[model samples]
Target: MAAIELRNIVKVFSDKRRGRDLLTLDNINLDIEANDFVCLLGPSGCGKSTLLNIIAGFEQATSGRTLVGGKQVERPGSDRGVVFQQPTLMPWLTAIDNIAFHLKLKGVGKAERHHRAMEFIDLVGLRGFEHHHPSEMSGGMNQRVGIARALLMNPSVILMDEPFAALDAQTKLEMQEELVAIWQKRRCTIVFVTHSVDEALVLGNKIVVMTKRPGRIREAVNFDLPRPRDITSPEFNDAKRHILALIREESTRLAQAS
Candidate 1:
């Protein structure tokens, strides 16, 4: 069975002021296999994040179904972890404590929580700064803390909505490398949403492109480029070219329609 399934999903928003409903997603169907690193690639306002939210059980689809591990997703659950564009860490909590906060809520003893959280701290390469609060850490470091917090739950899938969009170019590249390493080591299914073709190519084994709103799957491109991918290689450029063409085509069509 697929790790995550979106069956004929559709989403609409009530535009109260406009006195109409705006369709954001239309007849989307996708199956993400276990351990597949899937990137949802699309332009801004294309509803990639909405689709992700549906999979994460944070939002309900207007119609159709989302299943994770063969079970219908009714609401947010521990089986899926989500990291947003912002780190959203607690300002007062230290890195380790923030990562272990969920465990603490479940009444886990302090020592056990610390022990468990430490593993993820090391995994995200925040070992030395584990005691620092969010306010003290750099944006990249805080993002790592958020990632560690999600992983400490040991969720089967991770849903990320452009988590590196806020980082500086250098930090973004470093985080991308670290994220790929973590994904390889953890072997968990990840559905990442990003607008950047380069970021998608760098991180995903499969890239699912989406059209302009109302968003629909344009194509699912299999990218088998070896890890530590050579962005300058012919193969990488070819894939990027294909994806860019698709996006450009979509944009042209939308412009014509408008």
Candidate 2:
């Protein structure tokens, strides 16, 4: 069974200023299998984040249905972990505390929470920095803390919204590799949203291309490229070429409409 399912998802926003409605998503039907690293790829404002949010139960679609783990998704739950574009960590909380925040919310005690979160702190490579606050850490480091916090929940599905978009190239690449490694060992479903073709190609086993708003699926290309992928490999370039053409067409069409 699919870990997460969206059947004919539709989202419409009221635009009173224009005296009209804005259709943001149209008939979005997607089935993400368990342990798949699926990237929602598209240009900016294509409702990629909106789709992720719907699945996360942070935002509601105007119509249609979303199911997570064979149950209807009516609201957010600890089962679905979300890491937004920014690391929205509490400034005053220490790294370990931040990672354990959810557990704390569940009424888990201090010692137990710290013990459970320590493993993730080390997992995200923030061992010594556990005592530090969000302001005391670097951008990448804070993002790691954010990720660790999500993982500490042991979520069956993790939703990411361009989590690395703000990082420097080197740091972003490092995070990508680390994330891949984490997914490999943990075996959890991940839906990552990004606009960069290369980023999606490098990270996702399946790439779900989306169109301009009222975002619809353009293509769902599956990649067989081996892990620790060589970006310059012939097979990699061939796949890139196909994805780029689709993206180029999308950009042109959106530009004309706007």
Model 1 agreement with the true structure over 151-174: per-residue lDDT tens digits: 988899999999999999999999
Clashes of each: 0, 0
Give residue 219's error in model 1 in angstroms.
Answer: 0.3
Candidate 1 lDDT (Cα, whole model)?
Answer: 0.96
After superposition of all CA atoms, the RMSD between model 2 and the true structure is: 1.3
Candidate 2 lDDT over residue span 102-179, tens digit each: 788889999999999989988889989999999999999999999998998899999999999999999999999999
lDDT of 2 at 8: 95
Question: Which clashing pairs does model 2 show?
Answer: none
TM-score of 1: 0.99
Best-fitting candidate, scored by lDDT: 1
